[model samples]
Target: MEKPQRGIQSIEVGGRLLTTLAEVGEPMTLKDLAQQSDMPAAKAHPYLVSFGKLGLVEQDAASSRYELGPLALQLGLACLRRLNPVRLGTHAATALAEELHQTVALAVWGNAGPTIVHIEESSHPIHINMRTGTVMSLFKTATGRVFAAYLPDKVIEHYIDTASHHSFAYPKSDLRPSWKAMQKTLKEIRAHGMAQVVSEPLPGINALSAPVFDHEGHLALVITVLGPTALFDPALDGDNAGALRACCAELSHRLGYAPE
Candidate 1:
């Protein structure tokens, strides 16, 4: 094995304090911060003092608690600005496709509707007509429903009003006939943290989709995984759904989303 590269030990130790504050996500007293960082209060104080001078952290005058400083905010914004959600979502989809051995797709809101932007095909072929730029149904598709559940009501209503004018394929569903029922479905999707379709959009096919959010808690994209109905479990509590949720959660974290 190659010899390990060496770095400053003090910097690494100080970094733990910063990491702890970020993870905790609030102002912390010196005692709590040191305990969480697994260091004595005396040891952590010197690092905090240095961090204060560097603008990486600051202590509240009234509460006497430490929180991230303005420089840290600038650094986080800089990183978020450099991120491309589509690029990152595609990378995540590729890994999810391999892990689940199912077709995985990434969709973003387009002028028409939720449009597929990328696809990672499985080793086993799935005979769907989906491809890049394919616009999915806001009510019928798991991918579209994920967007509908998170996106603003006005946006969804606009599409609903002009849905007939568009040439997009909307597979038949009970929700199609009733607006109130569709709202209930959307609420359920939000509650479950994902949407699922079973043999509707296409016979013998099932899909599960989850949303990825950005630093501002805005929906960044939707990731959907699909396979034959016989092989894929459409259960919201199944292993497949669990894996998809985990993948989306990790992608959301990478995009700087901290859920409240």
Candidate 2:
């Protein structure tokens, strides 16, 4: 006997239509959807009708524009729940820490800044006052810089504006660099796809961090490794740096980020 077919032909075609709409990230009319899906509007109408009945597509009665339905949002939320960056980074961070014998941390862009969400510590303990939920500065730490390098300009602008008013232990003069210098640093970080800081955020500590991007090429999470400055060397080609980049690239791949 032959193996069972995986999916109905009509369903596969309908899925292509749905994906085309999703890729555009906007509601589209029948003509636009048909053209984008490379099908005739007459052919596409039937698929849309089925999708509408199933609550996978919704049409605006006024304009006849079609958008993803509530069910699509429900499905997207479910997918996001499964794609939690902290959960995805757990295994990778643990393996890196064990292999390199350094503290590995996972951070995500939080309301305040790059917020630590998970950590894997090596056998050798390092003294630093940080834990899950700790938010680091946008310019002072490797994890924070990786976020600064990748996050949108508006978000970084907000951070800078907020940081100026709130006083921190670090002298304001030191924390805020000339805009020119800051841009240059961020440019270099973008070029390298990673960031490193040595004994700046905290004395005697050194860190290197690489970004993990989502399918949209947005910063999803950052993986960082830290150790005593004396023991940790933040070399781009060094063992720790190479491992961190590889681990982050793997995570990004899982998130569907394909580099151009």
Candidate 3:
């Protein structure tokens, strides 16, 4: 009554076909894969078809190509929900927004970059409208830059390369030579555990962002408060710098970070 002993080896050619095709970042024509993998078109056909059906890969009609599929998203989201970093963030964001009379956003690094999937907007009309689910680049934004600044150089470099090719409506000066400002920004972020952008990326908008380090001490998310310049008090250190640092520390603590 033993099982058939299922494994990737059960597939044609022992899953070598699947491994090779899955590694291709962009879609590739079946013909191209057959040629590259040294497998005949007839032999490769079933693997692509079976893998695509399982959602491990996808096929494009116009080009007759295959690439990774949404199943990865399905799995990743399941993991994130179990981790529930957002739940920890939710309570903190609400409390802080109420206390400060400003907006609170919980952003996570994602495909489009730091997306604000949760937001509590200010009641006043003269407030910044950073709505939920708003996505941005990893460089030219407070939420985005804060995450990029805190992440390791490997992560930063990958995002920078991706961001450079990404399409966005901003001045070239804002993004020229991507790493130029990263080191300086990272120093500020590491020292204060947060980063600030004033009247930047847009007029009249100011933001303070802090890293939400996970239990493993890696940045898992970022909490950012943004508003019009008039709403922010330009003084915390007995000076503006001190006050901003305090804000960063406060947000970091709300995420369970005990500063040393």
Candidate 4:
């Protein structure tokens, strides 16, 4: 047996793979796994087995499918408790989602881009997202835009340049807007510390997003509440904006971003 690829084989790479799995909750095909893991199928196979053995992931019996197993869930929940943004954002998103009966997400910059760290689902079947692990761009999405806005122009430019319009397998063009337009949008987000986008990224998806600053006093994460376009308002209803701001303030505080 070729010596099991030993020692830290780029913790960052493993981190990215975990992030990918978190973003895509359902079991993925080997091809999908390779693409999402950014590794050759052959390479991923061994590690997938390793992870399965450790109970970090489970290989489904029916279709030999893979989804995060119970152990992984245990670890994830443990990590969530320690993660500042998750702690703050999860409660906030959950409350808002339950109150308005809309989907809410607390997102943050992961290895590749913006990733949904926590999600609160709506009550109705007409709700937006049913599952977690959805990844979207930091350029075109409301949460992404809030994330991009806080970064430098060069950082924002990179996201615009590298962003994929449709995140899945099928590569699509014309879905992405011009970089110039994205830059202008980022400018506005920077000024306001938040952004609202309607029916743009995915049709009928309306959302409001804002950045959460950390102890370093830099934007560290984003939180967004999403609903059908029919419920969107030109402005967030009474106290909603204040609630979001308060959440950001608390999260940032926990992260060591105390104001001077």
Candidate 5:
């Protein structure tokens, strides 16, 4: 492995104070900030003074508490502005496909519905009708269900109304016959942080999907992985499901999502 590059020790230590403030999400006194950073108040004061001059942090005159300054807000906004969920999710899905040896796809809420934007096929790709731009069923496919679970009721209801006029291959069974029943299903999906389908959308195929949220806690995209049922484990507690959730969680974190 290549040797790691050296860095300044003082700057790293000072950064800890800023990180603590961000995590605490509140103004903190110098002593409290020092304690949280595991440094002495005297040692941390100089860094705080330097940070205030740099506009990375500011102190309230009355409360005498330190918090992130305008510069910090600017930095955060800049980062959020550059984030492209689809681009980032596509890269993550590609790596996930390689790790799990299953086909992975990225879906976003399109004008029509949950539309697949990218697909990363496994070494032994499964033969399926799905491709980029294929809009999935809101109530049937795992991908669409994930969006339904997180999206507003109005959006889902609108799609359901449109589907009524057109044949979307909705199963005749009591999949979501009533609004109450649909809410219950959505509740379960939200609780589990994912949705799964076994041999329904396509016979002999199993799939699982999880949502990626932005910093605002809004659904940014959904990542779905599918494979032949015989080869894929669809259990919620299974290894495949665990890996899929982990992938989504990491992506969500990158998007600045902090789960409550």
Candidate 6:
């Protein structure tokens, strides 16, 4: 036998089609798929037929639309099984803590709100006590602002209620900015894809947070970095904010988020 090549050309071409489908995140007609894949319809159809036979792609008889099939789901689930968001985020969080020399946290959307599931402390020793399982306040902390900036309105409302009344230690008097003003601030946070808070929530503390998106384009988690205000600043376009955003974006990419 001659030297064996790594991959078949036809399979690689078909993979482009599958990736196009995934990137679109919707079913498409053969013509649309071919156009998107930059191939002729005739060429695309045969590959799709093969994919259908192998259970890699499926077609709706009623609508004549093509989509990823059960095998693709099985493969995706198998991949996701090993790539838990928190587990994946830990590497980035640890590196970020070392880079910034501050307290870094990874928070997931717990039933109560943005809950800190992991924390890496700075070697310099900060004066805060953020531990694992500690729930961050949705209205006060930088991590909570990130969730509020990205999560659905209903979920935001639920956490807002909790933070305003029961969960957060800060009373309403400490929560500055009127309701309308807070909305404007959150809008800015969403536009910037990060949040920053200085003092108020916890005196002498400053923080920055960025949201991590999953494959479904939903907010999966947030990476937050906090330190004493004397050293850390929460400016809109600060150096630390940029680093935090880069880290979150990297984690989001690992989770299969492709920005449009």
Off by over 4 Å in 1: 1-7, 166-176
- For residue 1, give model 4's deviation from the true position in Å: 66
Once superposed on the true structure, which residue ranges of model 3 sit more than 4 Å away at CA?
A: 1-83, 125-129, 166-174, 234-260
Total clashes in model 5, counting residue pairs 3 or more apart in sequence or in different chains:
0
Q: If the candidates were sorted by their TM-score against the true structure, best first, what order would they fall in?
A: 5, 1, 6, 2, 3, 4
Each model's Cα RMSD: 2.3, 6.4, 16.0, 18.6, 2.2, 4.7
lDDT of 2 by residue, 1-260 (tens): 99987878887887889989877778899999999998999999999998999889999999999989889878876776688677889988999999899999999987667889998988887978889988787777888888878888888777776765664423556456765578888999988888988887788898999999887788889999999988887898898889988899999877767687
> Judged by TM-score, which candidate is best?
5
Off by over 4 Å in 2: 1-81, 164-175
lDDT of 6 by residue, 1-260 (tens): 89987888888888999999988979999999999999999999999999999998999999999999999999988886687899989999899989988889899998757889998888766777678988776677888888878988787665555656765445655443454567887899989888888885889888889999988799988998888889886886888888888898898888878898
Q: Provide the TM-score for each candidate, comma-separated.
A: 0.91, 0.67, 0.57, 0.57, 0.92, 0.74
Model 6 scores worst on lDDT over the 10 consecutive residues at 168-177
Local error of candidate 4 at 39, Å? 63
Kindly list the per-residue Cα lDDT of model 3 for residues 1-260, writing each as its tens digit.
Answer: 98787666456472665556645546788888777777898888887788778887788888778776788547645755566677767876777777677677888877766788788776643444457777755666778778877777787667655565666423445454458657787677667666677787778877777777753467778887777887664232323344435544564554444444
Q: Which stretches of candidate 5 lie over 4 Å from their true place?
A: 163-176
Whose lDDT is higher: candidate 3's or candidate 4's?
Answer: 4
Clash pairs detected, candidate 6: none
Estimate, for each residue in 1-260, the C-alpha lDDT of model 4 and write its tens digit: 78866767566565555666756768877678778888887877777787788887788788877777788888756754576667766876777777667667887776556778777777743445435566665556788778767866676566555654435412334325566667777777766666888796778777788787764577777888677778655264434455666667777756656565
Clash tally for model 3: 3
lDDT of each: 0.91, 0.85, 0.67, 0.68, 0.90, 0.84
lDDT of 5 by residue, 1-260 (tens): 99999999999999999999988889999999999999999999999999999999999999999999999989989999999999999899889999999999999998778899999999868999999989787878899889989999888877766655555435534234666677888899999999999997799999999999999999999999999988999999998899999999999988988887
Task: Give the lDDT ranking, best first.
Answer: 1, 5, 2, 6, 4, 3
